[model samples]
Target: MLFDKKGLDNQTLLNLYSNMLKPRLIEEKMLILLRQGKVSKWFSGIGQEAISVGVTMALKNDEYILPMHRNLGVFTTRDIPLNRLFGQWQGKASGFTKGRDRSFHFGTQDYHIVGMISHLGPQLGVADGIALANILNNKNEVTAVFTGEGGTSEGDFHEALNVASVWQLPVIFCIENNGYGLSTPTSEQYHCKDLADRGKGYGMEAFVLDGNDIIEVYTKVKKLAESIRKRPRPILIEFKTFRMRGHEEASGTKYVPEKLMAEWELKDPLISFKNYLLKEKVLTPEKDQALTIKIKEEIDVALEQANAEQPIIPDRSVELSDVYKTFEYQHIESNSKAEEIRFIDAISQGLKQSMQQHKNLVIMGQDIAEYGGVFKITEGFVKEFGKERVRNTPICESAIVEAAMGLSIAGIKSVVEMQFADFVSSGFNPIVNYLAKSHYRWNQNADVVVRMPCGGGVAAGPFHSQTNEAWFTKTPGLKVVYPAFPYDAKGLLATAINDPNPVLYFEHKALYRSIRQEVPIDYFTIPFGKASLIKEGKDVTIITYGSGVHWALETLANNEDIKADLIDLRTLQPLDTESIYNSVKKTGRAIIVQEDSLFGGIASDISALIMEDCFEFLDAPVKRVASMETPIPFINQLEQQYLAKGRFEEELKNLIAY
Candidate 1:
């Protein structure tokens, strides 16, 4: 598989040389681009060009890559349109991300690239997921994730490796041995002498390659990547290379002594490869120039095309788009099921029925498989649904969500259970990035339902008892729902799962076993973007959601004189403004109630909406009932102070008296 001048035909060898040169020249030209306004920034990847280009070329065409910012060479070598590449740096619409993403988010899916740019090490988990998809699809496509030594220090790097090893997924984790991470050198990023030394801990076959040598980098990677894919296992490849530019355009290696920068520059990957090609008679200056000029011309032309193409303008109209796919709203027969169902069982029955209707549905989380999750919601389901449908994943939040997103993109309806709502942060990235924007970014839909036990009531300490739904209400492309009782939980869940968009179906942990009501054995569901009137009165509109609906409604029953209109926001993303406005118009007063802290909570959003839309109708200024602006306390006495205890009553009396 080695592309040696003596070993390969002239045509093949010449192509390799050309591929190696483009990245080098692009990096060289980028200096001028920075001076002009064309490319506002650059990650030179100068000395590492040969390794990125050569190794990438060695792999099959359809293989997937999650490369770091420094691996600019790899994209060019992989043949992403050059003009689009330049336009990306130019911050134009035709940029790979349609200009919605940052300059670094340039990988195109058509080129077998699943793009990412969170922190440095997060791509490892994603790479593993992409590779897992390929394995399941029985596609011989390998996934390669590249990062710097700084990224290797990240915990996700190890988590991804371990998961890949355990699942035996086909991913090549490549560590480009860039001597430093921004200002700090390799000394600060990790203690490992060589990164390969750390791979065995994850049960991966590790190998180190001389990244400065193009032939060596290519041959070794090709060997490992092919072997890993054929058998479909994971491997760790350490490419000993260097970062030739600042981390991004903003960073300057002022700390690195000029002597050190100059010393590293001597091992420039492109120059060294060129010398090898000439010495071996693989290429001459004339042929190299012809290739370079041809590529440059093609790139210039691509620039015209990409510039001519329009940027995908980000919009708010589609703000409610993709939260669910099935447009045909199904009726929720909640009234018929008023006999024997508990909140938790309703959730289970809803999932069971919906999954039965849809064959692509899958559910996974810690203890979700055999234990039916900690709440017993998924109980007896393991026997009925096979392992593929009900899976028990390791306790890694990133992995759990990442894997679910992977399954979802492959056309499976993935439902990820976050053991508790507090733990939902584990899978936040996949929820926000992959699922939320997949439809918008790639025009590909990822139908996913992320179900978590939310809210606090049972004395499960601060971590175990938390209503974190407010934490993610503002997240675009995500529909946040909190079902108070069994009826809505099942119906709303059905609506959430069937919808094209990704949903965060928050169920109260307390409601699981607390209250029981009768539910009939019929298929039914409730629509999103619509609100439910749990109780109706003429004094004040107490807008609440999730478990808060129960508390607010209960508070209303205490004093018959306080006729509060309870608007239950079954779906949070759409905000059900019409419901809120109608109630405010009729009652002439609005008071938002939620259990999350007052600041940055759903209450804030509702209050803002009320002031903007129903301001003219207000009897008084809007009022809100929420937790104190502090973390939930560990002590019960302290916790009471932090909880949303009696604001509903106080607000009710004040508004009536007003």
Candidate 2:
């Protein structure tokens, strides 16, 4: 009777068999639809359904799961409606993402299951973030993230695993070692035999198991899930399985060996489970057949229902609606200001005020707890908010970014601090792909702020000093804020914390201590996409932000004859185009300044916008003043020469003369 069924009850065995059968049948129908040109593409997990179904069934419904594309069985086993599943594939209006995406790239707050994007490794870090949040809230829950053997080779895999291990977060990493990454054999993917060995290196309990054996997978995963809930710890389990089909129907199995295909066919999870059910007398032939017929009828009806609905129209208007989760906040009177404070103190006060105002707000960064960060931005925050809310994280930048995404998914507003802006290169995947695009993809608010200490006036050198805001300014679905004044810094951070989209808040290192101004201690809100007009004149317009704004002011003071209109574009993405256009229209001359490099800079974009919107009002060609296209030199004099002050002053004088 198939080795006594591993002490699983007959009902449990029947449930497992049924769960394995549903996804296999659904994917089979999808393959038929693909051939008929009714569907685009399908990633088939036909043979390896047991692993997804087993692990999913083991966890409690409340525990979060981040499932990859192949884990269709996870959705089916969780009783996700077949109509919605088919609707997504058919690109119907009722689909989870409303036809914005076709594959595993949607999520629902109600379901607590994060749908995945094309990039695989970031989800693991996101799951770790969710688990860490659960721990902070003292919620007894474990998070499970799924990936393939190939994903283990990614840097994020190691980054997430190390953070989870060090923090002892409640997480289970399930690696399905199906022996091929799109056509490359597992032998070529890694030198080691088992992916679980990497888990051991990360200080986690690791194991390898028979993935086709549903009973063992369910029992072991259930035990581990229950244990981790009580005392949080991460574990890794590698399932040794094989994909019976090609990567997809289009990418045929030409690279697969005939002998290997034949071998895996003999161990087909669905057929083996059905045979076991029949041999053990778990169900009669008629009953088993009836169950199959029932599931098939259900799938067929779901397809019909999904097909009956209208296909989602590609509407640009609909795309614009959910770009940012804009909210209305209380506006204080004009004279509601409190006291004068430095830029660094304003940041500390803003964070403290945000945390006090919103209980769901938390701060996470490296050495931010007792050590108070390298710049002491978060100093004394630990004593006030406790260590649970203000957390000290490892040097895993990608994990930090992704975990904040997870926290936002769990209905928490997280503020992530990069010790230096240059280090953002390490976490660029999640920053650009996951955090920036989540809202536009699925109508979900990423609801996170990444605080970057940027600029190179202090000669922090190439590694620590960088002005990378230009990169994010060009990206859609992200709000890039670089505040110049202490008042703007405090007010904008408060607003960014409350924003329902991902905002990259760039705090210039040069202005952190050099600039101090009168700022309100009380919470205040600054509307996004609105630039502040620092000075108004008719001769020329100088548009800049962050540290560049100060340089623009200096140029104005030095050359009063120029009579320039100064505009500080506090938000770059939701750019204050109206202010820029109006100023350029009035002055009939414009100069864009930036701390980033000369070529391909934010000033270039601003210059283009001015040309398009105010061409009739122009007096001369739009000019741009930016740093030279090279890394910031260590010497202060060279760095000054590379900056935009002297060049911007010359441009302004020339514009006035013209």
Candidate 3:
């Protein structure tokens, strides 16, 4: 009977059967609803129920599991209320994501389940972070992350596996080889015979199992999870399964062979397990019928309740409320004890102070452990805080950033350093989609500060120097901070670290050593959404941030008659519009200077804002002085010509003359 449920007790066997049965029944009901046009979409895990059920039942409740779109059995097996599950599917306000996201895309911390994004690969790195948190906390918990065979081809898959292996993190990489990624066959995806073979390259123990066999899946996962808890290392298990249904309700399975579908239908996990249970006398006909009726009634009630609850209405306040967790504005009194330091050293001091304050703070990047990073900003951090907090990650920006998301999920604050701001393009998906959207989607606070060494003037070429702050500033739920001087750098960094939302802290590489000031040695935070009035005058208002502040200062210093009120916008997202409006109104003209290209830069947005709100007060047209629309040149002369430095003085004179 089911290959001898030898060590399993009668109750445990019955529980497994019920768990598997419930999802199967639920999927059937969902498919009916989809056809009836009640639900928007459905991703059916019909033939592959055993893997989700077995693996979930095997793990402890406290242990985290990052489930993909099709793992409906995971929610059901965890005994998450059917009402909430149905509500989520129905897109009701009662759902976990409050109708912000649909399907299994929402995660509930109460269930210790981190939900999957549409991009499946990032969650693997997120699971690594969760496992790393467990390790740091000395908890015996092992995290289990699931993905399809199609997802194995992703770079995130390789990066996550290697990182988990190197750290020996307790993670179960459950790969469901479902024979197809969307409509593409497995043959076209990868040439490897089995996905598990790829795990061997990462030096991880690999196993292949019949995913339809409930008993086998359950027994193996239970043993593996137990072993991982004791040894605390990663193991890859490839479950050979088939998707009996289409990828989603709309995408029909026309690409799959009819013969293969028929074969898998016969080997259905629920049918085989039911027959085995009946044969062992663990589940009689009467008991099975009663259980089916019970689950059906439960679903019926949940669906009704979900329907009765209000659907999401178009309310601006409600829509904007959950985008970011409110961080109380902190007022730090000026300290008497001050030490003169460079911008880089000020940032170092801020990080060290933050590390001492937050025990769970983690810093991760390449060469950050001992090399102190390329800029040496984190130099001696490993020695002071040890390697646990100061982590050196492989060149997997996507994975590390996703890991920071996971670490945030586990109540750990993290700071991810991008070697260069331009390199953020590699890790853009997780940062923009997952980390930035987590709070708005499911009320999850991503306490992460991504330290971006940005801007030009370093002669580091196109790939190294960039002012990409506008990318994040436009995205909802992300806080962007760009400081000018050493004092502002230290203070604003402290604020960013303390912020509950994901903050993109842009550190201009040019200002790192060139700028120096007396910064407070003690911990302090400058409030965000508040612009620092660098220099005040009545002729014109110069709105700028990062290196632009220095450019404006240099231009104003060279020309004493310009008499412009220079506003340093320390934070970009929660932009200090009030200050900009007030200064522009007072000056009757404005000029926005930026190191980035002229088109679609922050200056463009500021110019529009001035026109929209302060149009009547303008004596002349609002001007923008910015670099040329070209890749940052490696040659010093070409770079200088491309920068806004030469144009700022002329633009200021023209605006003042008008």
In angstroms, give how far residue 91 of model 2 lies from its true place: 1.5
Tell me, by lDDT, which candidate is best.
3
Which lDDT tens digits does candidate 2 get at residues 89-205?
A: 877777787787886778766667888878899999999889988987889999999999999889889999998998899999999989899999998899987889998789899
| Residues 231-258 of candidate 3: C-alpha lDDT, one tens digit per residue | 9999999999999989997999998889
Worst 10 residues of 2 by lDDT: 326-335
* Selected candidate, larger TM-score, 1 vs 2: 2
Q: State every prediction's TM-score relative to the real structure.
A: 0.91, 0.97, 0.99
- Which sections of candidate 3 miss by over 4 Å? none
- The digit string of per-residue lDDT tens for model 1 on 2-54 reads 23433556665566667777877776767776777665666667777766776
Candidate 3's TM-score reads 0.99
Q: What is every candidate's alpha-carbon RMSD to the true fold?
A: 3.2, 1.5, 1.1
lDDT of each: 0.75, 0.87, 0.92
Say which prediction, candidate 1 or candidate 3, comes out ahead on lDDT.
3
- Among residues 3 or more apart in sequence or in different chains, the pairs in candidate 2 whose N, CA or C atoms overlap within 3 Å are none
